[model samples]
Target: MIQKLLDSGLHWEKKEFGRYGFLKTSGSTDTDIYFVEKGSVRIFMMDENEERIIRFGYSGNIIVSLDSFLSGKPSELYIQAIKKTIVRTATKKDFYEFIRSSEENLKFWNSILEDLVLQQMEREKDLLISSPKERFDRVLKRSPKLFQEVPNKYIANYLRMSPETLSRLKKS
Candidate 1:
Protein backbone atom coordinates (compact mmCIF):
# COMPACT_ATOMS: atom_id res chain seq x y z
CA MET A 1 0.00 0.00 0.00
CA ILE A 2 2.72 2.42 0.94
CA GLN A 3 4.65 1.40 -2.15
CA LYS A 4 1.60 1.95 -4.27
CA LEU A 5 1.19 5.46 -2.92
CA LEU A 6 4.83 6.25 -3.46
CA ASP A 7 4.78 4.90 -6.98
CA SER A 8 1.58 6.65 -7.93
CA GLY A 9 1.87 10.20 -6.69
CA LEU A 10 5.01 10.88 -4.71
CA HIS A 11 7.51 12.58 -6.95
CA TRP A 12 10.60 10.77 -5.84
CA GLU A 13 13.86 11.99 -7.25
CA LYS A 14 17.17 10.23 -7.01
CA LYS A 15 19.83 12.49 -5.56
CA GLU A 16 23.48 11.70 -5.07
CA PHE A 17 25.80 13.42 -2.63
CA GLY A 18 29.43 13.13 -1.77
CA ARG A 19 30.66 12.43 1.74
CA TYR A 20 30.06 15.28 4.21
CA GLY A 21 27.62 17.00 1.83
CA PHE A 22 24.96 18.96 3.65
CA LEU A 23 21.42 18.04 2.62
CA LYS A 24 19.79 20.49 4.93
CA THR A 25 21.41 23.00 7.26
CA SER A 26 20.32 24.76 10.42
CA GLY A 27 17.92 27.65 9.71
CA SER A 28 16.78 26.21 6.38
CA THR A 29 13.05 26.24 5.78
CA ASP A 30 12.96 23.71 2.95
CA THR A 31 12.05 20.33 4.38
CA ASP A 32 12.13 17.17 2.33
CA ILE A 33 12.09 13.62 3.65
CA TYR A 34 14.67 11.34 2.10
CA PHE A 35 14.66 7.58 1.71
CA VAL A 36 18.18 6.26 1.70
CA GLU A 37 18.82 4.16 -1.36
CA LYS A 38 22.50 3.71 -0.63
CA GLY A 39 25.00 4.78 2.01
CA SER A 40 24.20 6.84 5.13
CA VAL A 41 23.31 10.25 6.54
CA ARG A 42 23.84 11.77 9.96
CA ILE A 43 21.29 13.99 11.61
CA PHE A 44 22.91 16.33 14.09
CA MET A 45 22.77 19.66 15.85
CA MET A 46 25.36 22.13 17.01
CA ASP A 47 25.85 21.99 20.76
CA GLU A 48 27.85 25.05 21.83
CA ASN A 49 30.94 24.48 19.70
CA GLU A 50 30.51 20.77 19.01
CA GLU A 51 28.39 18.69 16.65
CA ARG A 52 26.01 16.49 18.65
CA ILE A 53 24.81 13.55 16.56
CA ILE A 54 21.14 12.82 17.06
CA ARG A 55 20.94 9.78 14.83
CA PHE A 56 22.32 8.04 11.78
CA GLY A 57 20.07 6.91 8.91
CA TYR A 58 21.49 4.10 6.86
CA SER A 59 20.29 2.35 3.73
CA GLY A 60 16.58 1.43 3.72
CA ASN A 61 15.87 4.18 6.26
CA ILE A 62 14.08 7.51 6.11
CA ILE A 63 15.75 10.79 7.14
CA VAL A 64 14.04 14.05 7.96
CA SER A 65 13.96 16.91 10.42
CA LEU A 66 10.54 16.16 11.95
CA ASP A 67 9.95 19.46 13.71
CA SER A 68 10.91 21.61 10.76
CA PHE A 69 9.06 19.40 8.31
CA LEU A 70 5.86 19.35 10.32
CA SER A 71 5.81 22.87 11.74
CA GLY A 72 7.03 24.64 8.60
CA LYS A 73 9.74 26.30 10.62
CA PRO A 74 13.49 26.53 10.10
CA SER A 75 15.43 23.44 11.07
CA GLU A 76 17.72 23.44 14.08
CA LEU A 77 19.48 20.29 12.92
CA TYR A 78 21.83 19.54 10.08
CA ILE A 79 21.34 16.49 7.88
CA GLN A 80 24.52 15.46 6.10
CA ALA A 81 25.79 12.61 4.02
CA ILE A 82 28.16 10.37 5.96
CA LYS A 83 29.26 8.60 2.76
CA LYS A 84 28.74 8.94 -0.97
CA THR A 85 24.97 8.46 -0.94
CA ILE A 86 21.93 8.07 -3.17
CA VAL A 87 18.52 8.95 -1.80
CA ARG A 88 14.93 9.36 -3.00
CA THR A 89 13.34 12.52 -1.73
CA ALA A 90 9.76 13.87 -1.54
CA THR A 91 8.81 17.40 -0.68
CA LYS A 92 6.89 18.11 2.52
CA LYS A 93 3.82 19.24 0.60
CA ASP A 94 3.60 16.03 -1.41
CA PHE A 95 4.13 13.90 1.72
CA TYR A 96 1.35 15.58 3.68
CA GLU A 97 -1.05 15.44 0.78
CA PHE A 98 -0.49 11.74 0.40
CA ILE A 99 -1.01 11.13 4.10
CA ARG A 100 -4.32 12.96 4.10
CA SER A 101 -5.56 11.48 0.85
CA SER A 102 -7.05 8.34 2.33
CA GLU A 103 -7.71 6.37 5.50
CA GLU A 104 -5.12 3.75 4.61
CA ASN A 105 -2.50 6.42 4.15
CA LEU A 106 -3.41 7.94 7.50
CA LYS A 107 -3.13 4.53 9.17
CA PHE A 108 0.21 3.90 7.57
CA TRP A 109 1.47 7.28 8.71
CA ASN A 110 0.33 6.53 12.26
CA SER A 111 2.11 3.18 12.25
CA ILE A 112 5.33 4.83 11.05
CA LEU A 113 5.04 7.39 13.82
CA GLU A 114 4.48 4.66 16.39
CA ASP A 115 7.57 2.84 15.23
CA LEU A 116 9.63 6.03 15.36
CA VAL A 117 8.44 6.72 18.90
CA LEU A 118 9.26 3.20 20.05
CA GLN A 119 12.71 3.36 18.50
CA GLN A 120 13.33 6.69 20.20
CA MET A 121 12.26 5.28 23.56
CA GLU A 122 14.56 2.29 23.19
CA ARG A 123 17.51 4.51 22.22
CA GLU A 124 16.84 6.78 25.18
CA LYS A 125 16.80 3.79 27.52
CA ASP A 126 20.07 2.51 26.11
CA LEU A 127 21.75 5.90 26.38
CA LEU A 128 20.53 6.42 29.94
CA ILE A 129 21.38 2.99 31.34
CA SER A 130 24.14 1.48 29.21
CA SER A 131 27.89 1.99 29.34
CA PRO A 132 29.68 3.27 26.26
CA LYS A 133 30.91 -0.23 25.47
CA GLU A 134 27.43 -1.60 25.91
CA ARG A 135 25.97 1.03 23.64
CA PHE A 136 28.60 0.34 20.99
CA ASP A 137 27.92 -3.39 21.28
CA ARG A 138 24.20 -2.88 20.88
CA VAL A 139 24.70 -0.78 17.76
CA LEU A 140 27.12 -3.31 16.33
CA LYS A 141 24.68 -6.11 17.00
CA ARG A 142 21.96 -4.22 15.20
CA SER A 143 24.03 -3.05 12.24
CA PRO A 144 27.47 -4.56 11.90
CA LYS A 145 27.75 -3.05 8.43
CA LEU A 146 27.72 0.40 10.01
CA PHE A 147 31.32 -0.04 11.08
CA GLN A 148 32.41 -0.71 7.52
CA GLU A 149 30.14 1.90 6.00
CA VAL A 150 30.58 4.89 8.30
CA PRO A 151 33.70 6.54 9.67
CA ASN A 152 34.87 5.51 13.15
CA LYS A 153 34.68 9.10 14.37
CA TYR A 154 31.01 9.42 13.34
CA ILE A 155 30.18 6.08 14.94
CA ALA A 156 31.91 7.16 18.14
CA ASN A 157 29.98 10.41 18.16
CA TYR A 158 26.68 8.60 17.59
CA LEU A 159 27.39 6.22 20.47
CA ARG A 160 28.29 9.22 22.66
CA MET A 161 31.84 8.01 23.11
CA SER A 162 35.26 9.36 22.27
CA PRO A 163 37.10 7.94 19.24
CA GLU A 164 39.79 6.53 21.52
CA THR A 165 37.20 4.63 23.54
CA LEU A 166 35.62 3.28 20.37
CA SER A 167 39.04 2.08 19.17
CA ARG A 168 39.65 0.28 22.45
CA LEU A 169 36.20 -1.30 22.35
CA LYS A 170 36.73 -2.47 18.78
CA LYS A 171 40.12 -3.97 19.70
CA SER A 172 38.58 -5.78 22.65
Candidate 2:
Protein backbone atom coordinates (compact mmCIF):
# COMPACT_ATOMS: atom_id res chain seq x y z
CA MET A 1 0.00 0.00 0.00
CA ILE A 2 2.76 2.41 0.99
CA GLN A 3 4.77 1.56 -2.10
CA LYS A 4 1.83 2.39 -4.30
CA LEU A 5 1.36 5.73 -2.50
CA LEU A 6 5.05 6.58 -2.91
CA ASP A 7 4.91 5.66 -6.56
CA SER A 8 2.26 8.35 -6.89
CA GLY A 9 4.92 11.07 -6.20
CA LEU A 10 4.73 12.03 -2.50
CA HIS A 11 8.02 12.46 -0.62
CA TRP A 12 8.38 11.00 2.89
CA GLU A 13 10.27 8.56 5.07
CA LYS A 14 9.23 5.94 7.59
CA LYS A 15 9.22 6.77 11.31
CA GLU A 16 8.78 4.79 14.50
CA PHE A 17 7.16 5.64 17.85
CA GLY A 18 8.13 4.98 21.44
CA ARG A 19 5.60 3.95 24.06
CA TYR A 20 4.58 7.62 24.36
CA GLY A 21 6.10 9.78 21.68
CA PHE A 22 5.00 13.16 20.40
CA LEU A 23 5.37 15.11 17.18
CA LYS A 24 6.41 18.53 18.40
CA THR A 25 5.05 21.68 16.82
CA SER A 26 7.09 23.56 14.24
CA GLY A 27 6.41 27.12 15.44
CA SER A 28 7.96 28.55 12.30
CA THR A 29 8.01 25.93 9.56
CA ASP A 30 4.56 24.74 8.54
CA THR A 31 4.83 22.07 5.89
CA ASP A 32 2.11 20.48 3.74
CA ILE A 33 2.85 17.01 5.03
CA TYR A 34 0.72 13.89 4.73
CA PHE A 35 0.87 10.36 5.95
CA VAL A 36 0.93 8.22 2.84
CA GLU A 37 0.84 5.29 5.23
CA LYS A 38 0.48 4.84 8.95
CA GLY A 39 -0.01 1.79 11.09
CA SER A 40 -1.69 3.44 14.06
CA VAL A 41 -1.32 7.12 14.68
CA ARG A 42 -3.20 8.63 17.60
CA ILE A 43 -4.15 12.17 16.61
CA PHE A 44 -5.08 14.75 19.23
CA MET A 45 -5.94 18.37 19.87
CA MET A 46 -5.04 20.11 23.11
CA ASP A 47 -7.39 22.64 24.69
CA GLU A 48 -7.21 24.20 28.15
CA ASN A 49 -4.22 21.95 28.86
CA GLU A 50 -6.35 18.90 28.26
CA GLU A 51 -5.68 16.26 25.64
CA ARG A 52 -8.55 15.01 23.52
CA ILE A 53 -8.21 12.01 21.26
CA ILE A 54 -9.40 13.20 17.89
CA ARG A 55 -8.81 10.48 15.31
CA PHE A 56 -6.78 7.36 14.70
CA GLY A 57 -5.54 6.97 11.17
CA TYR A 58 -4.70 3.84 9.24
CA SER A 59 -2.58 3.31 6.14
CA GLY A 60 -3.04 5.13 2.82
CA ASN A 61 -4.37 8.25 4.57
CA ILE A 62 -3.21 11.84 4.24
CA ILE A 63 -2.16 13.46 7.53
CA VAL A 64 -1.78 17.12 6.72
CA SER A 65 -2.76 19.75 9.27
CA LEU A 66 -5.24 21.68 7.15
CA ASP A 67 -4.83 25.21 8.52
CA SER A 68 -1.18 25.03 9.30
CA PHE A 69 -0.15 23.31 6.10
CA LEU A 70 -2.26 25.40 3.80
CA SER A 71 -1.64 28.81 5.39
CA GLY A 72 1.90 28.20 6.68
CA LYS A 73 0.57 28.97 10.17
CA PRO A 74 1.24 27.21 13.45
CA SER A 75 -0.94 24.31 14.58
CA GLU A 76 -2.21 23.58 18.07
CA LEU A 77 -2.91 19.96 17.38
CA TYR A 78 -0.41 17.19 18.06
CA ILE A 79 -0.15 13.86 16.24
CA GLN A 80 1.76 10.77 17.27
CA ALA A 81 1.87 7.17 16.27
CA ILE A 82 0.68 5.04 19.18
CA LYS A 83 2.29 2.09 17.47
CA LYS A 84 5.29 1.94 15.15
CA THR A 85 4.42 3.34 11.75
CA ILE A 86 5.43 4.50 8.29
CA VAL A 87 4.50 7.94 6.88
CA ARG A 88 4.91 9.79 3.60
CA THR A 89 4.99 13.58 3.36
CA ALA A 90 4.89 16.41 0.83
CA THR A 91 5.84 19.99 1.56
CA LYS A 92 3.65 23.04 0.87
CA LYS A 93 5.87 23.98 -2.05
CA ASP A 94 5.65 20.47 -3.44
CA PHE A 95 1.89 20.45 -3.01
CA TYR A 96 1.35 23.71 -4.90
CA GLU A 97 3.68 22.60 -7.64
CA PHE A 98 1.89 19.31 -7.88
CA ILE A 99 -1.47 21.06 -8.05
CA ARG A 100 -0.30 23.29 -10.90
CA SER A 101 1.41 20.49 -12.74
CA SER A 102 -1.02 17.68 -12.17
CA GLU A 103 -4.77 18.06 -12.21
CA GLU A 104 -4.98 14.47 -11.07
CA ASN A 105 -3.18 15.35 -7.81
CA LEU A 106 -5.53 18.26 -7.23
CA LYS A 107 -8.54 16.07 -7.72
CA PHE A 108 -7.14 13.49 -5.38
CA TRP A 109 -6.66 16.01 -2.59
CA ASN A 110 -10.03 17.62 -3.25
CA SER A 111 -11.77 14.29 -2.93
CA ILE A 112 -9.91 13.50 0.29
CA LEU A 113 -10.96 16.84 1.77
CA GLU A 114 -14.56 16.29 0.74
CA ASP A 115 -14.61 12.89 2.40
CA LEU A 116 -13.08 14.35 5.57
CA VAL A 117 -15.70 17.08 5.77
CA LEU A 118 -18.52 14.61 5.33
CA GLN A 119 -17.13 12.35 8.05
CA GLN A 120 -16.72 15.28 10.42
CA MET A 121 -20.28 16.41 9.83
CA GLU A 122 -21.53 12.92 10.53
CA ARG A 123 -19.57 12.85 13.78
CA GLU A 124 -21.10 16.17 14.79
CA LYS A 125 -24.56 14.84 14.09
CA ASP A 126 -23.87 11.74 16.12
CA LEU A 127 -22.73 13.87 19.04
CA LEU A 128 -25.98 15.79 18.94
CA ILE A 129 -28.50 13.03 18.26
CA SER A 130 -27.03 9.64 19.15
CA SER A 131 -27.04 7.85 22.47
CA PRO A 132 -23.71 6.53 23.86
CA LYS A 133 -24.48 3.03 22.69
CA GLU A 134 -25.58 4.30 19.34
CA ARG A 135 -22.47 6.40 19.00
CA PHE A 136 -20.27 3.44 19.84
CA ASP A 137 -22.12 1.31 17.36
CA ARG A 138 -21.81 4.00 14.77
CA VAL A 139 -18.08 4.21 15.27
CA LEU A 140 -17.84 0.50 14.79
CA LYS A 141 -20.00 0.69 11.74
CA ARG A 142 -17.87 3.38 10.19
CA SER A 143 -14.52 1.81 11.05
CA PRO A 144 -15.08 -1.80 11.87
CA LYS A 145 -11.36 -2.66 11.78
CA LEU A 146 -10.41 0.05 14.24
CA PHE A 147 -11.64 -1.94 17.24
CA GLN A 148 -9.09 -4.58 16.43
CA GLU A 149 -6.25 -2.14 15.75
CA VAL A 150 -6.71 0.49 18.50
CA PRO A 151 -6.70 -0.01 22.23
CA ASN A 152 -10.00 0.22 24.09
CA LYS A 153 -8.78 3.15 26.24
CA TYR A 154 -8.08 5.21 23.16
CA ILE A 155 -11.40 4.14 21.70
CA ALA A 156 -13.09 5.29 24.92
CA ASN A 157 -11.38 8.64 24.69
CA TYR A 158 -12.37 8.99 21.06
CA LEU A 159 -15.94 8.17 22.10
CA ARG A 160 -15.79 10.76 24.91
CA MET A 161 -16.33 8.23 27.64
CA SER A 162 -14.44 7.07 30.68
CA PRO A 163 -12.67 3.75 30.43
CA GLU A 164 -14.83 2.15 33.08
CA THR A 165 -18.00 3.37 31.45
CA LEU A 166 -16.77 2.11 28.11
CA SER A 167 -16.06 -1.28 29.64
CA ARG A 168 -19.55 -1.45 31.10
CA LEU A 169 -21.09 -0.38 27.85
CA LYS A 170 -19.08 -2.91 25.91
CA LYS A 171 -20.15 -5.66 28.28
CA SER A 172 -23.79 -4.71 28.07
Candidate 3:
Protein backbone atom coordinates (compact mmCIF):
# COMPACT_ATOMS: atom_id res chain seq x y z
CA MET A 1 0.00 0.00 0.00
CA ILE A 2 2.61 2.49 1.08
CA GLN A 3 4.96 1.31 -1.61
CA LYS A 4 2.57 2.37 -4.31
CA LEU A 5 2.13 5.74 -2.66
CA LEU A 6 5.84 6.21 -2.61
CA ASP A 7 6.11 5.22 -6.24
CA SER A 8 3.71 7.94 -7.15
CA GLY A 9 5.18 11.31 -8.03
CA LEU A 10 5.50 12.27 -4.43
CA HIS A 11 8.00 15.10 -4.41
CA TRP A 12 10.14 13.95 -1.55
CA GLU A 13 13.67 15.08 -0.83
CA LYS A 14 16.28 13.81 1.60
CA LYS A 15 18.50 15.97 3.79
CA GLU A 16 20.77 15.52 6.75
CA PHE A 17 19.56 17.15 9.98
CA GLY A 18 22.70 19.01 10.96
CA ARG A 19 23.69 20.44 14.33
CA TYR A 20 22.30 23.83 13.33
CA GLY A 21 18.84 22.94 12.00
CA PHE A 22 16.40 25.52 13.25
CA LEU A 23 13.02 24.59 14.56
CA LYS A 24 10.78 26.10 11.90
CA THR A 25 7.97 28.04 13.52
CA SER A 26 5.86 28.98 10.50
CA GLY A 27 4.98 25.76 8.80
CA SER A 28 1.57 26.13 7.14
CA THR A 29 1.21 22.63 5.78
CA ASP A 30 1.50 18.97 6.72
CA THR A 31 4.53 17.09 5.48
CA ASP A 32 5.45 13.45 5.23
CA ILE A 33 8.55 12.93 7.41
CA TYR A 34 10.33 9.78 6.35
CA PHE A 35 13.75 8.55 7.35
CA VAL A 36 15.84 7.27 4.49
CA GLU A 37 15.84 3.53 4.05
CA LYS A 38 18.98 3.57 6.28
CA GLY A 39 18.83 6.28 8.99
CA SER A 40 16.98 7.66 12.06
CA VAL A 41 15.65 10.97 13.40
CA ARG A 42 14.95 12.78 16.65
CA ILE A 43 11.81 14.89 16.96
CA PHE A 44 11.93 17.99 19.10
CA MET A 45 9.58 20.57 20.57
CA MET A 46 10.67 24.17 20.85
CA ASP A 47 9.14 27.40 22.07
CA GLU A 48 10.50 30.92 22.18
CA ASN A 49 11.91 30.38 25.62
CA GLU A 50 13.23 26.82 25.58
CA GLU A 51 13.69 23.63 23.62
CA ARG A 52 12.60 20.09 24.53
CA ILE A 53 13.60 16.88 22.84
CA ILE A 54 10.60 14.65 22.22
CA ARG A 55 11.02 11.35 20.40
CA PHE A 56 13.40 9.27 18.35
CA GLY A 57 11.88 8.20 15.04
CA TYR A 58 13.53 5.53 12.98
CA SER A 59 13.13 4.46 9.39
CA GLY A 60 9.59 3.57 8.21
CA ASN A 61 7.84 5.76 10.78
CA ILE A 62 5.72 8.60 9.36
CA ILE A 63 5.74 12.15 10.78
CA VAL A 64 2.56 14.05 10.02
CA SER A 65 0.96 16.98 11.83
CA LEU A 66 -2.62 16.63 10.61
CA ASP A 67 -4.31 19.46 12.46
CA SER A 68 -1.84 22.27 12.07
CA PHE A 69 -0.75 21.37 8.59
CA LEU A 70 -4.25 20.83 7.30
CA SER A 71 -5.44 24.10 8.77
CA GLY A 72 -2.55 26.01 7.18
CA LYS A 73 -1.35 27.24 10.55
CA PRO A 74 1.85 27.05 12.54
CA SER A 75 2.77 23.66 13.92
CA GLU A 76 3.20 23.18 17.64
CA LEU A 77 6.43 21.27 17.33
CA TYR A 78 9.74 21.13 15.49
CA ILE A 79 11.70 18.13 14.22
CA GLN A 80 15.40 17.38 13.87
CA ALA A 81 17.63 14.41 13.34
CA ILE A 82 19.77 13.23 16.24
CA LYS A 83 22.21 11.51 13.92
CA LYS A 84 23.12 11.58 10.26
CA THR A 85 19.69 11.22 8.68
CA ILE A 86 17.80 11.42 5.41
CA VAL A 87 14.08 12.22 5.13
CA ARG A 88 11.54 12.19 2.30
CA THR A 89 8.82 14.80 2.67
CA ALA A 90 5.62 15.84 0.87
CA THR A 91 3.84 19.08 1.70
CA LYS A 92 0.13 19.61 2.53
CA LYS A 93 -0.68 20.69 -1.01
CA ASP A 94 0.69 17.44 -2.32
CA PHE A 95 -1.16 15.48 0.34
CA TYR A 96 -4.62 16.74 -0.53
CA GLU A 97 -4.10 16.51 -4.25
CA PHE A 98 -2.92 12.94 -3.94
CA ILE A 99 -5.97 11.95 -1.93
CA ARG A 100 -8.35 13.60 -4.32
CA SER A 101 -6.70 11.97 -7.31
CA SER A 102 -6.18 8.42 -6.10
CA GLU A 103 -8.19 5.95 -4.07
CA GLU A 104 -5.13 4.11 -2.84
CA ASN A 105 -3.64 7.31 -1.58
CA LEU A 106 -6.90 8.17 0.16
CA LYS A 107 -7.03 4.83 1.89
CA PHE A 108 -3.43 5.12 2.98
CA TRP A 109 -4.11 8.57 4.43
CA ASN A 110 -7.20 7.30 6.24
CA SER A 111 -5.21 4.59 7.93
CA ILE A 112 -2.55 7.06 8.92
CA LEU A 113 -5.18 9.37 10.39
CA GLU A 114 -6.62 6.57 12.47
CA ASP A 115 -3.23 5.70 13.84
CA LEU A 116 -2.49 9.31 14.71
CA VAL A 117 -5.82 9.79 16.46
CA LEU A 118 -5.42 6.66 18.54
CA GLN A 119 -1.91 7.63 19.55
CA GLN A 120 -2.99 11.14 20.43
CA MET A 121 -5.80 9.89 22.62
CA GLU A 122 -3.54 7.48 24.41
CA ARG A 123 -0.96 10.18 25.09
CA GLU A 124 -3.65 12.53 26.35
CA LYS A 125 -4.99 9.92 28.72
CA ASP A 126 -1.52 9.19 30.03
CA LEU A 127 -0.91 12.85 30.65
CA LEU A 128 -4.16 13.21 32.57
CA ILE A 129 -3.56 10.36 35.00
CA SER A 130 0.10 9.37 35.15
CA SER A 131 2.71 10.83 37.46
CA PRO A 132 5.97 12.06 35.94
CA LYS A 133 7.92 9.01 36.94
CA GLU A 134 5.12 6.70 35.95
CA ARG A 135 4.91 8.30 32.54
CA PHE A 136 8.65 7.98 32.18
CA ASP A 137 8.48 4.32 33.04
CA ARG A 138 5.67 3.78 30.58
CA VAL A 139 7.64 5.32 27.74
CA LEU A 140 10.69 3.27 28.65
CA LYS A 141 8.72 0.06 28.70
CA ARG A 142 7.14 0.81 25.37
CA SER A 143 10.50 1.47 23.73
CA PRO A 144 13.14 -0.15 25.95
CA LYS A 145 15.59 0.01 23.06
CA LEU A 146 15.32 3.73 22.40
CA PHE A 147 17.02 4.80 25.62
CA GLN A 148 20.29 3.72 24.15
CA GLU A 149 19.75 5.78 20.98
CA VAL A 150 18.65 9.07 22.55
CA PRO A 151 20.40 11.26 25.10
CA ASN A 152 19.34 11.38 28.75
CA LYS A 153 18.52 15.10 28.79
CA TYR A 154 16.16 14.68 25.84
CA ILE A 155 14.39 11.82 27.57
CA ALA A 156 14.17 13.83 30.79
CA ASN A 157 12.48 16.75 29.03
CA TYR A 158 10.05 14.49 27.18
CA LEU A 159 8.97 13.00 30.51
CA ARG A 160 8.42 16.57 31.81
CA MET A 161 11.19 16.31 34.37
CA SER A 162 14.58 17.88 34.82
CA PRO A 163 17.74 15.92 34.06
CA GLU A 164 18.57 15.80 37.77
CA THR A 165 15.20 14.24 38.57
CA LEU A 166 15.59 11.70 35.80
CA SER A 167 19.01 10.79 37.15
CA ARG A 168 17.60 10.28 40.64
CA LEU A 169 14.76 8.18 39.30
CA LYS A 170 17.16 6.06 37.27
CA LYS A 171 19.01 5.14 40.49
CA SER A 172 15.87 4.18 42.35
TM-scores for all predictions? 0.89, 0.85, 0.75
As a TM-score, model 1 comes out at: 0.89
Model 2 residue 14 lDDT score: 59
The 0-to-1 C-alpha lDDT of every candidate, in the order given, reads 0.84, 0.71, 0.65
As a whole number from 0 to 100, the lDDT of residue 169 in candidate 1 is 99
The order by descending TM-score is: 1, 2, 3
Write model 1 residue lDDT over 38-61, tens digit each, in one string. Answer: 989989999899998878888877
Question: Top TM-score: which candidate number?
Answer: 1
The sequence of per-residue lDDT tens digits that candidate 2 reaches over residues 53-125 is 7777767667666667767778776777777676666677866776666677677768777987887887787
- The list of candidate 2 runs beyond 4 A from truth reads 1-5, 24-29, 36-38
User: In model 1, where do residues sit more than 4 Å from their true spots?
Assistant: 1-5
Say what the RMSD of model 1 is.
Answer: 1.9
For candidate 1, the per-residue lDDT at 79 reads 92
Q: For candidate 2, what is the TM-score?
A: 0.85
